[model samples]
Target: MKSSVDQIRERFDNDVERFSNLETGQSATIDAPLCLELVAEAAAAATPEARALLDIGCGAGNYTLKLLEQFKQADATLIDLSRPMLDRAVKRVSAATAGRVEAIQADIRGAELDEQRFDVAVAAAVLHHLRSDEQWSTVFAKVFASLKPGGSFWVADLVAHQHPGVQSAMWHRYGCYLADLRDAAYRDAVFSYVEKEDSPVPVMTIVDHLRAAGFVGIEILHKHNCFAALGAVRPITGG
Candidate 1:
């Protein structure tokens, strides 16, 4: 049997039937609008137009759908580990824009993404899947190398709180968000799965890693409980 991380992809592939009750369908967080601002900033700085966007861990393609809408002329190269999610992404994004859309069903960390290849990169609720801080840093560098100068990387994810009392408060809110379902066992199972598979870290660590990877002008776009969005830019002049 596959481990939880492997199984999670299969579950996402089956998400169409389960999305009604899952967190996957939730709207973007309050700080998400700031991500759009960063995207627009990248667009304005690009030579021709902001026409090449990359989406990492694009589960079921929700984030890509938003990018397609925002840049109708931009093409997308979406990377994910699950083939089912990639297929679904293609179907959802194909008709929405005239720009080219391609899916690479591979792990983004080892994928062959060319340097200066994209104008903007987006990742949502994805980095927590990496098993360690080292792996997280590697993925950050991979993304940093994949962007063009002046390109920006936008990420939305859950992070670990540095303080224990604050951590409890954040978990309490996360639990409350699911409390309406009123299925204690179901909620417990979900969190148990998360505890076993997810390796979330403080957003500050990510900021440091992005800086080491050559991202400048970094900012935290928003924070709500444990969930937040962050934006970082690859400077316009660098090798």
Candidate 2:
């Protein structure tokens, strides 16, 4: 039996472009230009003294590259669990920003995020991958602690619906629709990978978890069916 991580990597490696394109179709991807715009907006909203940005679960540096493009002055840290994903992101960042971004490979659940703090933290297409409510809480708490007072955390991923059956139907439809556009082998790999036994957490629960972790002013900035972007601000007084 292959480990879940290995299986995921194999699927990704087999059809990176197809997978990227499928992901790009999501609200998070469709809202990429807008999201980057919002990040700039958030960065501007922060005190002028704050300039660093941390991108949690920065797979393939999609958002990381956009952030650098949108805000040339701000430095960014790209964190993810997959080394190959991080490597790709590093290359993308280097090509786009001439080596202005940093990359770190570690699980966001318990890894020490270094002493470095950021003015803003962004997690796109993540959160759902976490296996438990406690894991979600732990990651959010880490994000909260990694930020400066009044800093912002922007999170984007697939939101959970009230009806699991409806959600499953939508995912199946979308996945099949996308797979049709790609090669058969690639499509099978993606479908097989997604149809795993243990599903990840839903999006609404993640928002609740974030609030439980002490974030304030939580709101969904964008939504496209199950895909959405959410954000909250760290309290100005708390550690």
Candidate 3:
């Protein structure tokens, strides 16, 4: 029998196909190139030889494609809970990477990954959907388990604030401003999705989670508004 994570992944796969085709404004700009720049920077800093990379939640293959371009020698595995998203990504990266990029439709929370290890693991804009602290802990533990010694994990996500009033107000204003410029469908889908799952956790909590999961050398590499990039490394043997 498939696990709960597997069931969630099946649901997510269906939703992502709808989400990807909905003409949502956020889907267009809030993707790989912009997000992976931060991740690549963090990965490079953590290890000089990032020859193998794994991208968790690799929707539409954007970050995986960008990583291949930036790190020519790197082989990437792009895993997502969404089949349609993985299908799209596989098509996009297959040519340039000569099938060096593999896209898998599996939940990072519990699905079995390939036995081969990676120099870096990246998850961008994915943690918020986990819905619980224990889920987050489980996900981080799995990510930690997948890495090679000295390998790093890079994450970029929305950071929850202690005083959410100001940030909430700003997000409302920003949504309104964007609504005025974009089509109604675009605005509605993007804004509605963001608002529905706006329950973010503190950035420090994420850092702490990584540390508790046996990661070391943690650092925040980038920040823009509520979105931030943080990373940590697996310890070298006996150290």
Candidate 4:
């Protein structure tokens, strides 16, 4: 069985220090620094005047903190399942911006987000924890509803491929990368943890859900191995 929300939360609560770094980001993710840079840049380009930021699964606030460098005046709302993670994120993010920093200790699946309140939203190294197609659809719609007109939502996360051969190749490549990062034991541990804790969908599945959620201008920011960064803009013309 997949790890429960409580199990996931506990793991992250103890791992805040690893995620706190702004330079490297969460090292488990392939091209972690690159995705962080890409997502922040793309969000800035899409919403240069963004004044309100929502960071789902904010971790130690790396993604929000990176974006804050671009949107210095933006208020930040950070959500995470781990209170320790939230506390760390709030502390770091608050130190970076004079604007308001709100930390929400709750699963994004159940977090209540106000509609039309945010100019940009980011979810990095998250979303893969979502277990069902319905949950994915609901969360995507929630993010869509929470954005102001022209607001954009960005995601950087582990992604599964639809083709079996491609999936095997990517998984093998990711395993090799992890092994190279540390050792075979470390790679095995990570692989075992992911198998128990994650349920990622294909990048196209995410795009389809984004479209169904009323997002436009969907763009693939980057893709390498089993990870991807993507974004979509909420239409300025629609409700």
Question: Compared with the true structure, what per-residue lDDT tens digits does model 2 show for residues 14-125?
Answer: 5334323323523223355565556546545643455677888777776766566555667778887777777777776677664357888776876777532787788876
Q: TM-score per candidate, in order?
A: 0.85, 0.78, 0.79, 0.99
lDDT of each: 0.72, 0.67, 0.70, 0.93
- TM-score for candidate 2: 0.78
Q: How far is candidate 1 from the true structure (C-alpha RMSD, Å)?
A: 3.6
lDDT of 1 at 45: 48
Q: How would the candidate models be sorted by lDDT, starting from the highest?
A: 4, 1, 3, 2
Global CA lDDT of candidate 2, please? Answer: 0.67
- Per-residue lDDT of model 3, residues 17-98, tens digit only: 5333312413423332455676776677777787888888877665666567666757788888778778876776675575
At residue 125, give the lDDT of candidate 4: 82
lDDT per residue (tens digit) for residues 128-201 in model 1:
88876678778888888889888888888878899889889988777765554556675676677667666778
Using lDDT as the yardstick, the better of models 2 and 4 is 4
Across residues 1-239, which tens digit of lDDT does each residue of candidate 4 receive? Answer: 99999999999989889999999998889899999889889999999999999999998999999999899968999999999999999999999999999988888889899999999999988899999989988999999999999999999999999999999999999999999999999899999989999998999999999999999999999989899999999999985
lDDT of 4 at 161: 100
- RMSD, every candidate, angstroms: 3.6, 3.8, 4.5, 0.7
The candidate that achieves the highest TM-score relative to the unseen native structure: 4
Clashes of each: 0, 1, 0, 0
Pairs clashing within candidate 3: none
